[model samples]
Target: MRAEEQVEAVVVDDIAERLRDGSREALEEAYARWASLVHTLAVRSLGNHHDAEDVTQQVFVSAWNSRHTLRPDKGTVPGWLVGITRHKVADVHAKRARLARDAQAVAENTLPDESAPPPDDLLATRLVLHDELERLGEPRGTIVRMAFLEDRTHDEIAERLAMPLGTVKSHVRRGLLHLRTRLEEVDRDPS
Candidate 1:
């Protein structure tokens, strides 16, 4: 290998070790190595410097926060970083689209909007809900989603899934309990 290749190999190895050990420094080095490429990708997709910069920062921040979930056996760190950046960019586009849609709805609504204002804390609540749902696994997650997102009653979900009503209720109750605990943890975290 060339001298530069040797240095690159050493850096990858160091990063892999640090990542496995859950070291923040390793996560920082990994971000430093890929931030430029991630930024370029964001710029291309977003077509603006400010949006690209925002996406780039969000990508690294999310990646660092979720670093413990990284699997070295899956792919190279750079590839993983690219995947994270892509997802973040997609999220930015989705949010903008949603905002535009909401604005259009407001323009069209003739009725006095008496619905309670949308929760400002909804994003944090959603992230916590998703994380907790993932931990709850299959039937519990299904039941929770059905009840909350689909507006299905427990009996309705049970009938749809061909599960007993009692089982469905248990899953919903357990899922909510798990979400409550996870939300408490997020609230307690200083960062």
Candidate 2:
């Protein structure tokens, strides 16, 4: 190998060794080197910055907590971190799916028996739309839910959420537009 490349490899190996030996400075160095890689992978997998950031933090914390299990003989530190990131991403997916299912169950139970239930396709569509709404995250998600689902006035949502009227309106408008695009995609794919 080239001398420069060999030097880089040795440096990395030294950092990994220090990290596995329970050195906090090594952990910080590792984060500085690889946090962006982890964060980017998370953003690509999760499709949102908030969850991406959460997953990034979880990955480092997990790596530090489980450092004793890290075996350089098995793989490099980056490879180990990638494996942890994949697991964390899967966890987020499972959590999102579970939340969607719980929301669906609540909606189903609240229906009056005397009323004719919606068709299966309609119910499925509602579930997908609801899931997208949740993916919006934060003030946008809550604002859209309050404004559209609950049929609350903009002023009322503003008062209740303690957000400015303009901000509430903006969120609702943008959130609806995003949902509309998602609905269009669903219509095209129907999967």
- Evaluate all candidate structures by whole-model CA lDDT and list the values in order: 0.76, 0.84
For candidate 2, report its TM-score.
0.60
Q: Write the per-residue lDDT of candidate 1 for residues 75-162, one digit (tens) a residue.
A: 7788877999989888878766754553344324422234754464665665566666667766576677678766789888787666
Report the CA-based lDDT of candidate 1 relative to the real structure.
Answer: 0.76
Per-residue alpha-carbon lDDT of model 2 for 81-173, expressed as tens digits? 999999999988876775465446544543434467678777667777778877887668777877766678999978866569999999999
Off by over 4 Å in 1: 1-3, 110-191
Error of 1 at 20 (Å): 3.5
lDDT at position 43, candidate 2: 98
* Candidate 1 total steric clashes: 0
**TM of each candidate vs. truth:** 0.52, 0.60
Candidate 2 Cα errors over 4 Å, as ranges: 112-191
Least accurate 10 contiguous residues by lDDT in model 2? 105-114
Model 1, position 4: C-alpha lDDT score: 100
